[model samples]
Target: MIAEALITLSKPKVKISPFMKVSNSSNFQVSEFILKGLPGIYSWQHWLSPPLALLYLSSLGANLLILLTIQQEPSLHQPMYQFLGILSIVDMGLATTIVPKILAIFWFDAKAISLPECFSQIFAIHYFLAMESGIFLCMAFDRYVAICHPLHYPTIVTDSSVFKATVFMVLRNGLGVMPVPVLAAQRDYCSSNEIEHCLCSNLGVTSLACDDRRVNKICQLVIAWTLLGGDLCLIILSYALIIKSVLRMNSTKAATKALSTCSSHLILILFFYTSIVVLSVTHQAGRKFPLIPVLFNLLHNVIPPALNPIVYALRTKELRLGSLKLLRVHKEYR
Candidate 1:
């Protein structure tokens, strides 16, 4: 009798009702995610592949040309061109990280991305963005030194300083943004596996988590503001100082020439930062129009890289001449 009672006690005590349903929550952990590209336009989404592919190719070609031109020309080996080279590399990386996967989803209907791969994409995209912001800051400082303290420019902005700045850029962004992907990846994604964005953004991924994602969102905001926001503020200050120095010049011709040097940089900065600001505002406002923001995000990645080399080549006489010379030399060799 005692043995029988022990056996009954060893078995789990349970109460079953006719209305009770077995829970399937244990099996709901997502293994992969589906990228729903361009919400509300699934039928005609393939049409976007052609123009986007063209933009990607143009971005790659233009950045490559700039890098090659900078590498070949000894006279263009100043700190300014060195920073341009770095920017071209960063732009290529930033464009390449997202555009190919987007094209694949559009053309081939391969929207399934493994969980690990998705997180990796998140990390890469954010890292490249932070690096680009850092490079822009460096460029702005270079301009300030060139304009405001012309005599000290040679000593202050040397090849050694550029190298140090590059090191700092890599370390700062790499270490800074590492936690974004980690925080997203650690979440329990049991609710949904469908991401409604073209790329694996941190917010999109974290929002699908079954648990609280307030910490993830907060971490992302903190890092973004610390890196991108900090860089932007410093860049603005540098430009402000540059403007003040230019105003102090007595000669109108001298002032015009100084301001002319910064015009291209200003234009590029506006293009880059304006899109980011608009995207952020739209996201925070909880706007109903999703497609516009998605398209703007896609265009923001490709358009700047495609235009950067062109802008510099057009505005700066030296780059234009170098590009022409490089093209001519290649043609003659062929």
Candidate 2:
């Protein structure tokens, strides 16, 4: 009996089933991701490279010029132009975050991104995007104060206030987006390591995981709606109040001035939100034509960066003159 008991103990109380599935995801986890770079347009990725590269170049040049102009012309250092300066930085960062990788994918077919690099890219992309969203909200508030309460604008949006707001924006957005990558990192990506997008977005990568990603998906959605949605709501509210104030002005010139002050910003805002909305819609409803959404997503990131500075320069007289002065100085130098 003693021998049998010892043998039974040695044999194990229950036989282990070799056929049973054991989730050793760490062993089978994907080490790298193959960025597919726009489904159904595989043959034409080459053609898309030049335009995208040009867009990135334009964004970089325009934003750099804006930064230089703002720095050189001390008079351009008000809350409005200061906000534009911040926006330019955000736009440049956004373009820089994705465009290089996109060009590599399009031109060289260098689509495989390792897990760590992929996550890092995700962090940067999300961080800048969130920062841009918050900056726009700040810009809207600046406009609101300028147009609605011009008398108190200086007091409310002083250099000190702008500095504090910028600091808060940086910290809030940076901290808010940190969790997105962490949640993505926690997911087991053993199903397939192919990302359907040009970049390693939180949604695109998390969708490739084999495990239950409900939490990841839900967290991403929550973060998006909370940050972007909240900013958008406040922007709309600020504009609404501005419009109300503008309408109350009896002078046509005053009304026109107020509306004109908002026109450039509204254009950029429209471009930003329209692209996002169309991209989201294409994802849900235009699945049959995948290229449309993919291109929209790329455009959404690249075009705003390129066009924002141009729009602002064209609309704002000070910026236009500053650009001209810089051009003259360059001509004189050369």
Candidate 3:
């Protein structure tokens, strides 16, 4: 349903490398293929805003509830909950960065973002991605402590350790994700810039190139696997240790309860990573399967942030009760 003028601009005769060739007709010799422009993808973003706004509102409310409950309930103010607080803060950033923009696209017919706005989106998304990955790594270590050293959980995961871990996570993600923006800025875009999906993703940015993109693609692949993959392996190791520790326990009920406590965490991590991996590898190494990567990114990165709290908090008893207590307290004061 594209206009003929836009279609004409969509394909320029350039000499793109074979890897970049999605569909090469004898007539269309693109040096570098221009991906679709950014105008239409978010054109109806205003319509998309309401649902995303609701999601952010809900996540914000739930996180606030969790944060307040953790502060008020003496029993909940442990190192684990402290990390949960940190997670909430990071999740807030993650949601804040994306949801409002998405909402803007939905609520208004105009969906154009300036270059700076686009860059900001890229930075925020990568920053949050790094934070989320770093936090999960921290969370794994937290679980390792709780399960493996029940007697020494308090002494081990102390305030200082937790604080240091938080700082480290932020710094690591910041430094680690810093390269992407620098690399992305080097690429040139002419007419084609519209990404098929919402959000400013590296893949989307790289696709708009009319120059060599192999360097970007390789950097992306390396960073993606290195960060996310490392986190996943560490988590797996932590759980392996956790399972060993759980089996060592004499009481079956207690063991079951402990595992159950982490079930939500386990499930959420699986969903997050699985989507991430699929999204990473699915980008059209070939031109024909273009929409697959788009769908993958949209589903995994966008959808899971909203679903995270639902899986983590709503179903977990401590979080559920904590929410109730906060709500009840607010009702009483009113």
Candidate 4:
């Protein structure tokens, strides 16, 4: 009823996006106008959101538990745990940014996101995404410290250093996305903001500009390549050094122990980076599997955070036992 009411009451207002410089651009006239909410994407979201919401929420819960557990138990307050907590926060922020909005469309067919909202989503998602990649790089460095500089690790990765690194990432990524939305505002609107995807994705939104999107496109290209490329290079280098160190270990048992710790990190790295590479290479290249790539992007964007707890934290004996202990203490008191 609310959806129907909102849809009926809300008359779509027409305005030119600032970046769109097309002459005579107005509602419904531009070749590729960014539309405010259309019902088409919403129709599909109805059937698709429940399962996705479950998975995202589950992951959110797990990550929150992990963060809290690490904070309460002093033993877990090392650099590694702090970095893991930062990652959990970023993952939670990243998933919440995209999924719930889509779910709302499914529940209520009011598919109209204002231009401001669209820009907001773009800004938030990209910022967190950059931060997520940066965080992974930090994780790689953490692993490198444990393996390569075991003697000096305590000094190198102190809690103060971890705090600074987390702050810098959040600030840097948040600032890094400024050009996207700021440039998007210049586009002139022609009233066709009907994005095919259920999300207010970056490229999809950018393509709506009636004016030359060269500025925004360059920003996207620069940020994508810089962050993605930098992360990949660092990860590879870290692994190479790690392998070298592990090889030099005197005892097989010690080396095996080191490798075991690495196994989970490697799995996550593969999942996150490979998905990114595949998505970037295939994006709008008119590849045969556009929908498939979207689904994979969805996975890359959300599933890592959802599966992260299970993949890295929940599987750990210490975290698991600590969580159970906390739960039992809470239940007994209740």
In angstroms, the error of model 3 at 127 is: 1.6
Candidates ranked, most accurate by TM-score first? 1, 2, 4, 3
Clashes of 1: 0
lDDT of 2 by residue, 1-334 (tens): 9999888789634332231223574445466789989878788877988888888998899999998899899789888899899999999999998999989998889999877788888888878878888888988999999888999987999999989999999999889888888887777776588877898878778888777878977887788898988999999999999989988999999999889988999998887877777877876754587677667777777788899999999999989899889989999999
Q: Can you write out model 1's per-residue Cα lDDT over 128-218, one digit (the tens) per residue? A: 8889889889999999999999999999999999999999999999999999988887777765789877899888888888778999989
Decoy 4 TM-score against native: 0.86
Cα deviation of 207 in candidate 1 (Å)?
A: 1.3
lDDT for model 3, please: 0.71
Candidate 3 lDDT, 16-110, residue by residue in tens: 43223334323432232222322334334345456657777887876776778888888887787787778777788888877676555555433
What lDDT score goes with residue 109 in model 1? 92
**How do the candidates rank by lDDT, highest first?**
1, 2, 4, 3
The runs of at least 3 residues in candidate 2 whose Cα sits more than 4 Å from the true structure, single-residue gaps closed, are 1-27
**Cα distance off (Å), candidate 1, residue 185:** 0.6
For 1-334, candidate 4 gives per-residue lDDT tens digits of 9999998789776564544445553535443323323233433546676788898889889999889888888777777778888888988998998888766766765566767677788888888888878888888899899989999998998878888988888787778777777777666655556775656777777676566778778888898888767887999999999999999999999998888777777887888888787787767652565565556666777788888777876456677777778778879999
State how far residue 297 of model 2 sits from its true place (Å): 1.5
TM-score of each: 0.91, 0.90, 0.81, 0.86
Superior by lDDT: candidate 1 or candidate 3 = 1
Q: Which candidate tops TM-score?
A: 1
